[model samples]
Target chain A: MVTIKDVAKAANVSVTVVSKTLNGYSDVNEDTRRKVLKVAEELKYTPNMLAKNLKQKVTKSIALIFSNFERANGKDGVLFQIMSGIYAAAVDFKYEVVIYTRSLSEQQNISYWKFCKDHKIAGAVVTGLKTTDPYFQEIVNSDFPCVVLDTDLASEHTGSVSTDNVGAAKVAVEFLISKNHRKIGMINGHEFAVVSRQRLEGYKAALSEQDIDFDPTIVVNSDYSEESAYELADSYLQEHRDVTAIFFASDLMAIGFMNRCREIGVRIPEDISILGFDDIVLSSYTTPKLSTVRQNFHKLAYQACEQVIHILEKEEKGRHIMMPFKIVDRETIKEL
Target chain B: MVTIKDVAKAANVSVTVVSKTLNGYSDVNEDTRRKVLKVAEELKYTPNMLAKNLKQKVTKSIALIFSNFERANGKDGVLFQIMSGIYAAAVDFKYEVVIYTRSLSEQQNISYWKFCKDHKIAGAVVTGLKTTDPYFQEIVNSDFPCVVLDTDLASEHTGSVSTDNVGAAKVAVEFLISKNHRKIGMINGHEFAVVSRQRLEGYKAALSEQDIDFDPTIVVNSDYSEESAYELADSYLQEHRDVTAIFFASDLMAIGFMNRCREIGVRIPEDISILGFDDIVLSSYTTPKLSTVRQNFHKLAYQACEQVIHILEKEEKGRHIMMPFKIVDRETIKEL
Candidate 1:
């Protein structure tokens, strides 16, 4: 078996320096740490503390912990894009990522440390978790290295990554306004989600900027699901037929509304313009292709992984990262 | 700190039976095995032989090893569906799954056993691997418990799971033939994939059954990519306009062809009928929706995990399982 001595010799470093570097000590110089770690990895020198204790002290691995687990499985949405970024970054950083989920029931039953210890995970990136989830609190308190997506815990140990939701929402609504759409309605996600609140603020900000009074009656809070958005749009359209355009918080909801519109004989762009957020995979493939605010989930995931790994390596403090977003102009939006 | 005695006592089983059950001895009855394992899990009685030796005797975990590493990150495809199934099944079976990939360079640099031992994965499910891969042969010869997808190794320690690609192909082609289309063109994925060959056989079988002459000029081999398929369709349409319908071995290719057709002024169903395989999530949402063959990738993944676990438990010899497939009809096809 390759030993620390071999790696230290190859890197021309003392065993003490090698040990400190492997254990994530901050005193090691960046150049020396890089040389030592690179040599150790090339030699495949895994610290087999498993022989002394069943739990490993360190491993070149990360975990992607997901809440609302179904999103982890859906490929047509932001989750897949985020995973793509994480996977690419993991390959580049020479780390393996294990995908897992801890349900509400499991959260109450096990400590986050035990979960990570059992899996021998070095660090983690968490996504889709709501603030109310007990696991969220556990993550906030645990000293374990982690980064949460689309939520801000403001912890020293835990980082956060997300799109500039408020800015992206404002851009989407402003695009509609630029197209002379004044009677614009909005469909937002659940109130408890940080993204929903941020997006709502953006919507209101855009309306206020245009001197258009925010119509509370025209805004509907949905559960970020297509079925709920579809039903909401169906009823909202029947009562508020004068609304020229609608802005949805997610592409799934936009797609659902489009499906419902087709059933009700409402033509897209011609009868009513639509705007969506996230620009999920389905958004581009759908007929008349949805025009929406494109949040780069891949960049968000990449930043989260990079931040968590940097924290693990003791190279940087945790950061609150907001990835870039832009508007994708397609067939869904029309000039009145 | 829980021991075999506690688990045995809680489950009303002998310590010997509990040991045998945990160690994967088939002599233990099914009910007794379930009871003992459940009790052991509840008591958190993980065998800590890692202290004595780095190799663990038993672990409640499986490895999902993917080939073609790109597919692992793609959400708009069958890979995601398979992963979803595996994740769900693993949660039910009390097994933690680790997802990993061994690149061709990595495979050549390390022994398969060493790779598994380093990761401490008890068993693995390998998907998207070509038969020519060195790791595939190593897996086939090794005693490690495994289940492979879309390929048959016929190894006693390994099982295979896939839709009846040949049969599904025949059904799809026959559906096109039934609509009075005689000059049918087939676009196939790379020939190295077992699924590609099987689907080819199916296409030929359908033609043979209908007593229609198969023309070599009308067939195109693509690399299972939309870009390749789009280019092939573009060129094929320019040269062979007489071909009334085309059967693409994958939905991605069909979608690519559709996009190309639109660019070149060809109409679907009106100018030519179209058929696709693998009815991905986007298939249902596309314009005129896709008329294609649907393979239940979720069930395919579920069975792969179940088979791998069954092999790990020493319950039965690994079996080659063929999942069912069906033709999904929508607006993409029309009777000639």
Candidate 2:
């Protein structure tokens, strides 16, 4: 097969000049272009049809944009699972997946849309960006095809995939209520996260359903970190001595809270029942185990990638897709 | 900037014709080639210099080749940490990282060297290959730069980074000896893994150092999976009632063994003390907090990436680099 280099050699000009002349750039002089063309014809060099077609259409490439893939020995269960899912899905779709990890600070200066354009990406799957992030504004205004994980933005080209946090949280609290635990406290992640707000709503909805008055003092906000959860749980357990159970927004937090309980000699289920969300792997390994709401992160990721690919392939607007959640009953919950 | 499309239009030929004419194809008629060349020259189209340069040299790209990224919510701690480290280092070096995941069977057909050549990768960091793998034999013969994790092969272009498994295992067994825990047993990963063989050597060395005769009957081989370890440990514990302490080759296996002990009415440390290797994140969170040898996977990864990049940029041959390991004292070990 003939190559671009052969064409350049035959034309007596650089490959770049030949490429520019063929690619519709506006800089080549007509005389040089004519000479190069004449030599290429005499040499019988044929342009690669595949390369030409590739240039004519949008490339089948997607970006998995993450913010801080966590430090080592860090809690990255959900993130890892999601990445695995996206990669697996991309393999099936035959779309190339490129990962771009940017810290929150770096995200301020990097436009996600511009990044996609520069990479010639057809779409992107974004994760770990807060709603208040400047990138969120860029995402909302741009027409780039994007599917965000665990976050929502109203845009024609942007889709979102997250578990039904409100419903899951309600189920978690309701399960505790069924066990006759009315004095249940809530430990939530950062207020900036949309899931946090939705979980809080679910908690309140469960309380109202059970005719139990909502207690604002029992709800503690944390930064979705294990250490923060431990600290917050320690303080909450110290002050709210009467509270019989607590619902944590994440399994990592629940583990931290359980560790705190061990330190304080507070027995799970006997002294207080606990429920968590996103039943991470550690939840099952913990002694007495943990009862929590499970999010289908793999399915969420698959759907997110599927959605973005759909929009790109079909030229259709994107929509939010919610994954189902279920309550996993283990040793963490007990009846009064 | 003059473009090929413009030249093609002016010369009344397709872009491919113009491209082929300038690129030196011998298939085009001499008359048409002359016309296309003249048109391209008149347009003053300069080929892209960056693209041309890219074709002349090896791309600054590296491959993170892995055997299976397991589907379990298991201890992917080392794998995840190493990936994080490699990505971090790649960012500093401005190298692009591509990941290739293929099973041993798939690897039998895919030549690692060819993969790098096809992808234009300068080097690769390989993980999870057994010593007997056919790919390892290929790697031994190929001059492609590679830094393998937890394995050793004698090749100038191939380097390896892993914790001193033999020394670490020796230290672990010696710690048990210091605690007066004689009659120790071992639960090791598959023999195909170089680490497993090293650990076994270290175990025997420790026993020899203590003037104790090595008992081959007490050592059991597992597939390095948590479930496999659980079954193997259960059977081993049931049969070897005389063994007082057991050292697991991996933390996941240790956790599984501990869980098996729970089911079989054996109390950890009090009944049969256990020590584990690879202080995974969950090791610290386990009920009794596992006492294990900590592999600095992050550092190993950083060093591996650095070494491969050095070989690529400086044209230096690679060498094996061993990372240090330390024992983390926790509740799992009891002084006999």
Best by DockQ: 1
Each model's RMSD to truth, in Å? 6.0, 10.0
The worst-scoring run of ten residues by lDDT in candidate 1 chain A lies at: A48-57
Q: Which candidate number would show the highest TM-score if scored against the true structure?
A: 1
Model 2: per-residue Cα lDDT over B174-272, one tens digit each:
999999989999999897778999999999999999998999999988877788888876678778999999999988899988988888889988998
Error of 2 at B169 (Å): 0.9
User: Per-residue lDDT of A1-336 in model 2, one digit per residue for the tens?
Assistant: 456788888778899998888776879999888887877767656564335434564656688887766631446377677867887788779776767787777777656765666455679999887888778788867899998988766468998988988888888898899988889999898987999999999999999998999999999898777788887766788799989999999888888888888888988879989898898888887877989899988789988998899888897787888889999999989899
- State in Å the error of residue A140, model 1: 2.0
RMSD of 2: 10.0
Candidate 2: residue B163 Cα off by (Å): 1.0
The lDDT per prediction is: 0.84, 0.81
Model 2 chain B worst lDDT run, 10 consecutive residues: B48-57
Q: Best candidate per lDDT, number?
A: 1
Candidate 1 lDDT score at position A70: 69
